[model samples]
Target: MTDTSKNETNATGAPVTDEAPNTASADVEALQARVAQLEKEVAEYKDQWLRAVADYKNVKRRTDQERADLIRGASAGLILKLLPVVDDLERAMNSVTPEVYASQWYSGFKLIPQKLQTVLDSEGVTPIAAVGADFDPNFHEAVIYEAAGEGQGGKVVAELQKGYMQRERVLRPAMVKVGQE
Candidate 1:
């Protein structure tokens, strides 16, 4: 005397209901939605991490450049200060006549300037080409403009003071006399 109206049963007496398929389908849909949400979150996190890594690389590159610039700048200042001494030495050496330069003491004077040049070279210092080159304000400061002939016009005819650079950056512009055509 089982009540047939209360529940419907299959062959082994398990209750069968019309809502079962709907319930299982709803659960599957919910699980699929959760999976999609998690995937989106993962994608977002990955994007953020990649951006952070890229930012770090940029910062590192900037830091290295700054460090190199600082080192170069420090040397530039020191070299600028020493330029006058080098100029004086050159002047002294040039003033000596060829006969006087042949003296034993002259060798010592020559060595001093050569050693200074070697130090300057090792520090990446270079002289700006002023005499005979086209006068450029970036590398030469015009001290005077003089009348010139033919090819000498608009070019540096004389360097009043030698200009120097450190690693391509101008430490001082060369004082020059420019030719006026």
Candidate 2:
């Protein structure tokens, strides 16, 4: 048996090997098998690369959402701190006498509180309902319990200090007086 790939011609110029067909078929099969293996490996690597890119995109999207949320709610702490001042202003307005209420100074004082409320409204800060509504632990903190009429048990009778919410989060839980039988 001659190795046809390196076979030399005899003096008559005829090749010595009789295995041309077998050699060609075997070489074709080997080349076909190598091509298939390369294709399979390429497909596997492409799948992995696609998954990695998708994972990176998902992480980037999540980070962007978190950053936006942080920027949107950055004023929450300052608003929380200023609520006590707002409460004091409201109390002062409630304690004013009719004589003082008609004075220029009283009107100016009233406008200040109104401006504070306007500022709160502009920031999406909203006052939680306490009076007459059912007492909710999520929105109200019961500081004192008071006597209630029928059908009013477990309801808020008064708000000692107003509670506030920014967006959907409770910035301050309303200090309230709950009523019971």
Candidate 3:
């Protein structure tokens, strides 16, 4: 008669097969979910790194522009303050008559101012035109108003103090008398 026991050995001495363990499928699914989550995290970190690099480049560019502007303004400020002294020297040169022009002292005085102006010109300091030109509030400051004759309104009558510019920026505004209709 055959044995009634469920556990039996085959001819090769291996145990008889039964259903697979219930936890096997569940463990495989959990591993796949973990892998997906790790991939998403890696993508987020990559995006953050790209943004940080872009921000650093932008900040560097802005700082460079500001520094260049500061250097330009420093030079312009020094030149603007020296313009009045230059104008006075010019007036003094003009006042010297033909007799005075022949004197050694007058010649030295004139040469000094001319040489100084040449140096200033090399550094990008330049004068603004004020006489007989149309009034521009950006470059001129009206110190006095005068009654304009025919065809003279809105014109610069006289310059009290000369203005100057460095490159494209106005370093000093010209002090002037304006004519009005």
Candidate 4:
């Protein structure tokens, strides 16, 4: 065999090898391909991670909104039950004589329901209109129907029981009497 070290140099004056050069080039190409593939995989994994994080944030926001809504509804129900007591106090205060208004007990009773109603109004609880308007099935329940004197049909003649709303949602339907033609 010829001396490989002596035959290694090519005509371009660059050092050349018999086996090591080709082997080294092939190994470098393989390493580059491997690096490209790993980069693509890393990018895919990063995209998946970003999507997962966004989904988790959306779920957390939805849960917080629902919890807040539940708390508001619970408070509204308690206030709704107290409205009848307020109405009774109003009646009592209206019917009280001048001598009774001068008494401490009568003044205390009058102030209590008014304060309660003021608090409820500040919290978005409101009474629905049910008297003399057209009866609506969505907000009013007609327990009694009667024929009016003239030109009255599908109109609410009387409200037997009051209704209430909280933030555009009906908390209770009005019990009413409707006039029919």
Candidate of highest lDDT: 1
lDDT of 3: 0.84
| TM-score-best of 2 and 4 | 4
The residue-by-residue lDDT of candidate 4 on 51-169, one tens digit each, is: 99999999999999999999987887787788787667767776989898899888677778778778878878788899888889999999999998576699999988788888788
- Per-candidate local distance difference test: 0.92, 0.90, 0.84, 0.85
Off by over 4 Å in 3: 1-32, 104-109
How do the residues 1-181 of candidate 3 rate in per-residue lDDT, one tens digit apiece?
A: 7543447766887655443244657788898999999999999999999999999999999999999988887877777677778888878877878998988888677778889889888988788899899999999999999998887799999999888887688888899999998
Candidate 2 regions with alpha-carbon error over 4 angstroms: 1-16, 97-100, 103-111
TM-score winner between candidates 1 and 4: 1
Q: Candidate 1: where are CA atoms >4 Å away? A: 1-16, 97-100
For 95-158, candidate 2 gives per-residue lDDT tens digits of 9899998899887777888898898898889999899999999999999998889988999999
Each prediction's TM-score against the native?
0.85, 0.80, 0.74, 0.82
Model 4: runs farther than 4 Å from truth? 6-16, 97-105
lDDT of 1 by residue, 35-91 (tens): 999999999999999999999999999999999889888888899899999999989
RMSD of 2: 4.2
- What would the TM-score be for candidate 1 when compared with the true structure? 0.85
Candidate 4 is scored at a TM of 0.82
- The clash tally of candidate 3 reads 0
Lowest-scoring 10 consecutive residues by lDDT in candidate 1? 2-11
